[model samples]
Target: MNYLHWLSPDVDLSGDKAKVPTSGASFVKYFQPSPPASDPPHRYTFLLYAQPADFKMPKLASPLAFDLVSFAKAAGIGEPKAGTFMQVQG
Candidate 1:
């Protein structure tokens, strides 16, 4: 789901690879993945979106009961550039 949220406001995409020392970057929401114990495997999807230069990061109250679709719609980041998913067991 929405376990982790990391943002790099200004990343250096000049090179072939993205540099790590991004400007104004941080994890607004710390990583906290809690795969179910009973379920042998849990599916997780990750999406990459482009943010505007002036886009602002938001503080979340909690990961619980969070709606990612609504948030993405409000952010207006448009369609995701890339996406992938993985399965994990608790």
Candidate 2:
């Protein structure tokens, strides 16, 4: 499941490292990772999808049931341009 989601079209992608867009971005969902319950812990994934200027974000009732495939189908966004994951235990 996704722990956080943010979108920003104004962000400059040419930099050596990630930086906030000059126009700023909006968070579809806040970052909230639950305490790991397993020995291996739970994996949290971050995805960076290229949002078109005409892209319309679908209204989600709950993030709990959020599915990437379903979301892409609804939002009409293409495959993720970048992504990463991590397992956190606390």
Candidate 3:
């Protein structure tokens, strides 16, 4: 989906291993897995956010959105809003 006013930074995106300080707002909570079995199937879910289209990314890149909120604010996306979600089956 295309939001008409979000800006993103020009940076190399990587895995969560590169932990940025948690904003608490932008993170995983209440994550639960399915029922038990002889060999439980593996499963995972994730939430992703991006800047709106109108905003323009800065020259310097940010590792996480916790810091990027400042950038988003400047672009006019305001407090980053959570988008739609999807579910995965194991």
Candidate 4:
């Protein structure tokens, strides 16, 4: 099964990694289209991948700056199986 880390724009995952849930290598979150006042709508995207038989979470300095393609290659997740996005207005 694949393991996923759900991230939010305002929520910090650095100290709350333990609270994140694990699924079939995928963790999904609701899309919040609305940003704070004076801010622009953020693009929320989902990146799906095929998890390897044996997988482990790699140490990341900043999860927010994570590169999807690079992570997939390092984790042996292969290319994204599917993807989608939504826009929220501030």
Candidate 5:
């Protein structure tokens, strides 16, 4: 899900390597994932992209409404260079 945003490119993944930092050099906390506790186990996938030097953050009504494709295009981020996933039981 496109729900987590990381504000700094210097994001620290040392705490939880499984969770990727969503924000980049231009924005912070654009979206975040929320797996309901009542739901069954779910697999969370993350796509890592290379942000362009001219990348810019897009305006949004809410982080929940953030769209991955649109955001990537707007921010000049190309297709994911790498990816990772983890399963969570909620």
Candidate 6:
């Protein structure tokens, strides 16, 4: 599985700022996996939400780090499920 790191638009990817902080990690490290199969590799996902907004994820974390949706939920600043992203595969 490939590792992924995400940051809100607020965070800078310019490499001039400090490194980003992780809210979570892979499930493999946290849970047991099924035995290997004669099948293609499965895609496992790790989702990380930013900490509450009144507080920041962490300094030097992401100047712009923090998911707007998650932040809204954590802060109770907006309605739930107000927005979402969608994709269609051909």
Please write out the lDDT profile of model 3 over residues 25-88, one tens digit for every residue: 3222333444345544443323234545565544434332334545455656565334444433
Residues 11-80, candidate 2, lDDT per residue (tens digit)?
4577798765555456462456667565567777777777778987687766665677888888887898
Q: Comparing candidate 2 with candidate 5, which one achieves the higher lDDT?
A: 2
Tens digit of per-residue lDDT, candidate 5, span 1-90: 455444334334457563445544435543344578998877667676665666566765555545878877776767877778888775
Candidate 6 local lDDT, 34-73, one digit each (tens) = 3257655544333333334464332232323335455445
- Which 10 consecutive residues of model 5 have the lowest summed lDDT? 4-13
Q: Single out the weakest 10-residue window by summed lDDT for candidate 2.
A: 2-11
Which candidate tops lDDT? 2
TM-score to true structure, per model: 0.66, 0.72, 0.26, 0.57, 0.60, 0.23
Q: Supply candidate 6's per-residue lDDT for 23.
A: 43
Output candidate 4 Cα RMSD: 10.4
**What Cα-based lDDT does every candidate model obtain?**
0.62, 0.66, 0.39, 0.52, 0.60, 0.37
TM-score of 6: 0.23
**How many angstroms is residue 35 displaced in model 2 relative to the true structure, after the best TM-score fit?**
1.9
Off by over 4 Å in 5: 5-26, 30-34
Question: How far off is residue 79 in model 5, in Å?
Answer: 0.6
Count of steric clashes across candidates, in order: 0, 0, 7, 3, 7, 2
lDDT at 54, model 5 = 65
lDDT against true structure, model 2: 0.66
Q: What tens-digit string does per-residue lDDT give for candidate 4 at 23-49?
A: 333233443344677877666776545
Candidate 1 per-residue lDDT, tens place, 1-90, comes to 445434444545579975555345464534545677887786677666777766665555665556677667766777877678888888
Better of 1 and 5 by TM-score: 1
- lDDT value, residue 45 of candidate 5: 70
Task: Specify the poorest-scoring 10-residue window by lDDT in model 1.
Answer: 1-10
